[model samples]
Target chain A: MMRLLKIVLLVCLFFGCDKKAERPSAFLQTQQIKLAPPRVLTTSTIIDSSIVLSADFKMEDVKLRYTFDGTDPTENALSYKNPIQITEAGTYSFKAFHPEWTPSETTTVKIYQKGMDTIAIQLRTKASIKYPGMGAKGLVDHKKASLSFTDAEWIGFDTIAKARIDFGKKVHLEKITMAYLVDTGSWIFPPENVIVYLNKTDSIRVQIPNLKSDTLALADVEIPIEKTVQYLTIHVQNLKELPEWHPGKGLKAWLFMDEWIFN
Target chain B: MSYNRRSFLKQSSLATLGLLSGPFYASAFSSNNNKDVIIGHNSHRYKVDLGWGMLDPSKTPVNDCHEMVQDSKGRIILLTNHIKNNVIVYDKSGKLLETWGTEYPGAHGLTLVKENGTDFLLISDFERNQIIKTTIEGRPVLTMDYPKETGLYTTKNSFRPTETAVSSNGDIYVADGYGEQHIIHYDGKGQLLNVFGGRGEGEEQFLNAHGICFDNRDVHNPSLLITARELNQLKRFTLDGKFIETINVPGALICRPVIHKSEIYFAVLRSKNSSDFDSGFVLIMNEKNEVVSCPGATAPAYQKGELQELYQTVRLFQHPHDVCIDDDENMYVAQWNSGQTYPIKLTRV
Candidate 1:
């Protein structure tokens, strides 16, 4: 106890004598304690093939550790040396650490592959520049849709978006699926209805109900396609007006969606 | 001594301005002198002058240089919390004209008003929980204690006033930004006329109501412009404290509203969602209420008529608390927590 007291006194004296011109403030202290997670950069498209995954951090001295088994990355996890070669698809999550900084926010990526082959698609209207959804080719890129509307893979539309896929030749398809992000705070809402034209005359449709919460969520809609067709078109509608609780109340809502997978 | 007091300072010991040896006189100008010499965007660009108002710290030191105002004579008045000189006056050329006052320990807000051809200053001290009206030369003329008549405060400390504004009718409106976020109005005689607003998220309430100023631009319907710093919003109210409108400038933690012809100029203390180090800039808006330029930050970008979040693009300023624009359109920026440095001048280009 005497030795500990002496050590504490010495530390206080040392710090007291060192008249540094600049010192850490209360705001910096709080920020250092609030650990920020790291970023896991991976494309949403998944093909039945190997992929590469990497981590991005703001600071150079930060050390990254990652895991691929759907578990949170710990400091003891495998130290990130280079981009991981992801041959097996799963969840890739990572965290960053520094000696003087707090741990970074945890980030994860989903690895998915295209379920089908030999398909050409075209979008009628160009995507919004802010959220281009990584271009129309991203729909059939075999990548899964992400929940974050800000993701480069999510295509944003001002009012509505229509996509038509040409198989070139007649093909057999069973399931049609697409992912959407629902974040009401940013004026992004789920589509009011999703309609698919199997041919020209006959069509099937699915409606998304009104959302009550402001939390960001992902909605993946899947429709079973038992008929064989040469061309398939998708019509996703945007919300006309936002709810009353939001700041942009009664304003036109934004529509954000990721890749459309046809299996 | 050479004009560069900084060079002389480097060769001396910790002694000057009745101040002891301390780290407060740490380097002020950033190392990248060339890049930081010029900043701003669009037609409102400015030539940065970091060397302006450089004083010998041992003689006239400052802590948290909060607010600045230009008088009719074109002289600049700076308010600081340093006990040695709560008020420092300067000329357009950054020459020290005078310094006075040891009463204001937490001198946070300074508002200059001309009444009957005489200029007076409203000094708000949060530490003393009072607003003192004094002549430009630092003679205390009137003292206003906590507003017990408002029934919002039980003690003086609970009424820490941050800003005060004088109307065209000579009515003094005090905004207790640090304490209750209440706007207390009183006749020039210091009798409480009325009180409105409190702490809340509603349009009528405020969080960190840091500033208040009278908008006489609309001669027919003058109003008060107040700041809600935490929400990055400026709430305008009628002379009687009626809510008029809320102008939202996202990512900008504004200090006070300094109005010029066809434009409103103010210092953005810092930007929200930015690293907490001194991410500040000067924001200017046209008469149409559209942000025209952001000096020391990236040019303002809007999407679908909505302004995007703004962050620091140039490291010219650190926590700029107030901006005083001269008749020539030049700007003087007073900073907070910026190494006890003096005000920086931005010459309009």
Candidate 2:
């Protein structure tokens, strides 16, 4: 009887230990590091249009490094903490390194000719980002691109109106030129019913007439400044409506301004 | 109840092998008697460019298409979730004709029905957790919220209705796919008729009751329902909610099935490891509950790793989300989350 009891006890012990082993323990070591926001650096001058870039996780104890040219980023290359100047007007790729993890990487920006003064812009909601000629394809990288300006800038309005630019500073009076980037044969979203105003009054607003490729170049509408105007207002009325041949059924609005030349 | 890990693996493996065997291949290639059966690889070549006329000239072409149906006038309508706009209409030649339904932020399932010579569209909104019907021109005709009459659902928008099936008499069967795991039925006028199945491992239950269709071929007692039980195999049921029998196409992750002229053709989303070029296959089932042929068949045994290299020609499927057979026995398939979300047509040669 005692031998039988011992066998039963051994089996019970085996099964009990097995159950305990199979149970997943809450003390399993786990570490989660939230990704850091993308780093962006730009020069105070518009001519030197290169922007330094890096991304580093603050929680992790790893050294971050980046490179500007097509070469690999080394210790001598710009560090994550320092601002790297982008002097050239070409596409530059950058890579950020962290030990024991996949490298957080980003593409180089395409620098355009400085046309106007930089006006800071922030999206109230998640705005649809896009390139001027390429529809919807280049919008995915909007978060990485810097739409904010750091210096005082002048913007001309056809009339006096309330204009709000994110992180923007108002400068002295200046003549303004408004040129719409139009891709003649290519398609664009939020089709041309935009009204430009100097002030909030509708009397100063001018309607942009629709022009096709055969009739006008994609850079079609250019409004020349006659007076030194301040407080520029752009009224994107009929923003909810899509183009006549709009292949998609949705609502999206965007403001694309290149250079705001300051006097 | 505890989920059975061992039994689940064993059943799943057996089902997979059973589906991948020669019998399933045979059924996929052959027509069940006189019924016309056409099968081909679900191609990922066509894409719907949603930026055809938008103001933002930077939109990418839509790539992931979930469901497809032909309209009364033979225009191919695609239900996609690649971008904000869910539904897109195209001509049979894969040209973008028109598009709409951006309001449904999460559109998943799309089925077209022509009643009284007017084309009607039924869509399953995944985010909204509702089923809606509209006209061909994108007008909201009727919207069916979660049936409050059915006391089974616990959450407010619990019914994530996916693919839908319509009977000759206009009865609608909605497979509550990503939600409460129930198949809800409604009359032609949108009255809640019945509800069956829930989240369970039992024979009659389902893990993800993805798609449903009405089998009206049998005249005497037309089977009221058929479903793609994602985990528990395929199931057929009576209109009164009685479980009849189970059909197993093991290892085959089936997305949807359609019956045309007494033959059953099922769309199998190519297994992740499969080297088949078509990312999916069509299985033809005979009355004896056996697979007669597998159209677009791959080799019985190619070195497993070698399949991926020959993926382009290997009768493989990417993610065949839905299938429909037209009156001319032409097979139409729509793949989800692919590089190109367009319908692939296969004519019975």
Candidate 3:
């Protein structure tokens, strides 16, 4: 009887152990790891060195730590907020860590000093006009009808009047276009007055003669050309200001322009 | 100015009709060698399907169908731009067999030649701005950078060579399409022979002179120069920097042209509207100097509310940037802005 009981006990124990092993446990443990380093933007050559580094993580409240020289990363390193800039020539190392997660790995990059890389600049033209009749508000305001340059140092434009623009420096101009949003029941007459200034210096103002308000029209213009100009001015001279135009009830204008090519 | 739809369509149709009946069309389609030629007026129809064979998984590494050349084994090897997946080898039936060239970035132009019983592939890399010669299996045999030793390129490393043409005696010509707008000639072993053309609007000048092919059909003086000027027209030139003639193709923005079986097929983008956006067309000109068949001709139309609704008509093309004709006369068109973004095959009816 005792031998049979012992055999049964051994079988029961074996089955019980197998069942326990098969059943999935409620509490699971995982070891998550990340291998990718932070993104680093460097110049084409190491000679003219400028590095921009950024680290982004999904974990909550993670802190990024970085060092300029080659060294072992520590927890008390300087934190990173925006993209870190490196102008000097040397090696850079970075790391990140979180309180509730594994420490982010380290990465290294090299930077070198170089000369001035040639930057190609392209200038585009944007010109438009707005008119408000007598006892009406003005058409487009001056501030909204301005042009924005990508590299302002390479080129500059001064608004001579509400309609004129002055160009500075010689640059290869590739394309010119205009964009405007007009109100309902408004129109623009003689759309051909949009001219470009060919020579350098002096403000070129746009003059709008015989202008009216309260009509709708498609004020988009595009001229395909490639030319070299040292100075350029956009003239919007034919606009007629109205006496009834006030600050709150004047013609509102909006213009947007882009895509310039200069070699 | 008020938008006049009826007048615009009438004027444009007349202009197109006038262009289709030009002198080049007269000579290109006529037969003089006792060969029977069938000329059809308005015989070519326009048809368009916005969603035809364009359905592939996004980011699928499909091989580019740049230029097609026949191999010794009667297979069609495609010289791809290598921008997506380079160097797709296809059969004559448009079947994708095997592909190579993920390593060569910006592979723009391709040409194939057989010399000494060995087949070689010539590739132009726009990013590297150099010409590379490789074996059929993608092994680099010779690589030529900007011919600085020839003192041709005024700008250093600015030669963005596009396509190539080879002569019977193994002279190679490279078209600098993107960079200098010049043609560089070389020997079989990649030695710089000479260079011509520059950035100008003159007779020998080129704006975006994209493609070149050897015209060997003329028996008397077989000139070896052809160019696809993107803005203006197609130009024929002598091998030695001489302008032979200019073929005017109005209302068509040409991209590339290739010759097959004594016929010339040029890819063109026709603006559907006066808005200057690209609708596509392909023109087939025979030796007699007439457009015997025009495939994928599209008309421009403005949509009621769509932002520039340029309708592609029957046989209408959507930016047919490059075209190739197989041995069976089936047309393969590579588009830049078609919804499919893959090469479309049009079987001849």
Candidate 4:
């Protein structure tokens, strides 16, 4: 009876005292990693006489540094006082650094001037209601999506979109880049196959895959046309059916696109 | 009832490892300010109090302060997902009264219902896929597993209950907000009465129907107000599941509908866009459903009966889930996925 009573008392004591169950250590694990590179938002269109660019960071105390030379921007580089103005054709870089946070990587932007003039812009299929452009005039609006998927600046297609950018004046163009948004959960996927037209004769069809990422991604893909094109047109074919793992599987996917950048 | 702490802990640990597995970070803030920030607009302005419920997290940790409710005894009851102490009861002055509960790993919703002058809690566990009814002292009187009889859920995981609303006559309406977006209505006996509202963008359909509650402002003519967070609208439905009208509060991802006096309030989970993380505010709507004030966001504006795009102005909260208004009209906010922080108090000025 005495031994049983002691065991019972011990069990009661054990039950009475409860220790705190901290969050899993793996969740609280901290790492010293470099911060994300500073974002650069250039003028609406880079094909201008002079290009203007801006750089900013979330932290108020973080100082921005930049360099127009080929050297990487560092703490010792010229401190950013105002928006950068580039007149000559060259690439410029910028970076941000703070004492506590990890220093951001060097971000570079190139300046270019295009001589071709677009005479007409028409859509093969009109964009949907929520993401329609300014009635095709938005194609040459000189505004691009600034890392925002739902920025109201891009035009989205329900399944597919086809537009022709009639550059009346022919110029030497080797590559064409298109800005697209990838957020699979929102039923927004990238173009599956892109067919580009050069001078109404030569055409190139390039297949693009769905970007496998959970967070929002502002991605760009370039197709090497490798020719001095006259009339340029683009055909964005959205994903016919989403993958089985996706919640909206078998449903038609959407494609969001901003200005079709010309290079 | 004797406290079988060992058995509770043993079962809680085992169930937590399986049902509530996730990585969570707990934030630590230094005690400093008395009242440096004041939020809200017009007559609803309030002085902020960050130290309202600052407890030793080592002993009482919270994983998503999902909801808050004030009982008749004037004790502030907070429901969190942390199984170690799922329910933390505190006085209005932020004094710790007692802590109990270890079964709710996905403890998301909390509704304090008064029955025969006695108070009970309805906690919706999204992870375990169950809704629990317990006494004031943490005694489980009713355990409602997935409503298999409703015919809405074919599999158990498809019924993720996020919030519940108990009618005056004891009818429990569980919003499967995180599930297939159906509001399962049940009687006091836990028998299914009806099921309505599914996944669609129409007036009757819901996209992330996160919250549901009976708006008894008229007392005689009460209706259900449901939240379509993605659509940024609060939908009013007849008690029998018919869509009546819609209240559009653009750019505000409003959560559950909370009523105190004549005005209705809810924590805007996010604003401007659904993908914008940690951007949240609080909105107060008058009896006409016109937003009177928006706490932490731009002032409520309406031009030609269309609300302008509203976004956060003062960064006061991150992903606020629900708001509880005390008898003194003081506001207490609970947050979700906010680094394991406690509820913030806003004393009305």
| Best of the candidates, TM-score | 4
TM-score of chain A of each: 0.59, 0.32, 0.30, 0.67
Q: Please, what are the lDDT tens digits per residue for candidate 3 over residues B242-306?
A: 88877655455566667787777777655322222334567666675445555533222224422
Q: CA lDDT of each candidate?
A: 0.74, 0.48, 0.49, 0.72
- lDDT (10s digit) by residue, model 1, range B1-349: 0111011111011111101211122221111111223456677988765557878788998978899999989999999999999999999988999999998997988999799999999999999999999998899999999999777789998988889999999999998988889999999979999998889889988988899998888889889989998788889999999998898888898898888876888799876654333567899988767788888665777788887777654334667899999999999999886667788788887
The candidates, ranked best first by lDDT, are 1, 4, 3, 2
Model 3 alpha-carbon drift over 4 Å, by segment: A1-161, A164-263, B1-65, B79-84, B154-156, B270-273, B298-315
Model 1 ranges with Cα > 4 A deviation: A1-263, B1-36
Lowest summed lDDT window (length 10), candidate 2 chain B: B1-10
lDDT of 1 by residue, A1-263 (tens): 21232233234333432244233211101111222345455643374667678765433356888887889887798898787777775667787765433354456665654667667888977778767766888776766555556567778887778988898888787878777777665678888888889977968898888876554555667777888888888888888887776666787788888767777
List the candidates' TM-scores in order. 0.56, 0.45, 0.50, 0.63
Instruction: Residues A1-263, candidate 4: write the lDDT tens digits.
Output: 21232233234233421234222121101111233346567784345667777875534356889888767887899998677776765567887675533355576765444423454778988788877755566555555665455677777788678887766776778777776777665677788999987745688888986655333556667788777756777788988887766666788888888666666
Mind sharing the TM-score for model 4? Answer: 0.63
- Report residue B196 deviation for candidate 3 (angstroms): 1.1
Supply candidate 1's per-residue lDDT for A247.
Answer: 63
A best-first ranking of the candidates according to their TM-score comes to 4, 1, 3, 2
Report how far residue B349 has shifted in candidate 2, in Å. 2.8
Model 4: how far residue A48 lies from native, Å: 8.8
TM-score of 2: 0.45
**Candidate 2 local lDDT, B211-290, one digit each (tens):** 77778778777775455445626788887678898776554556666666777766665432232223355455555444
What is the Å distance of residue B91 in model 2 from its true position? 2.7
Candidate 1, residue B338: lDDT: 66
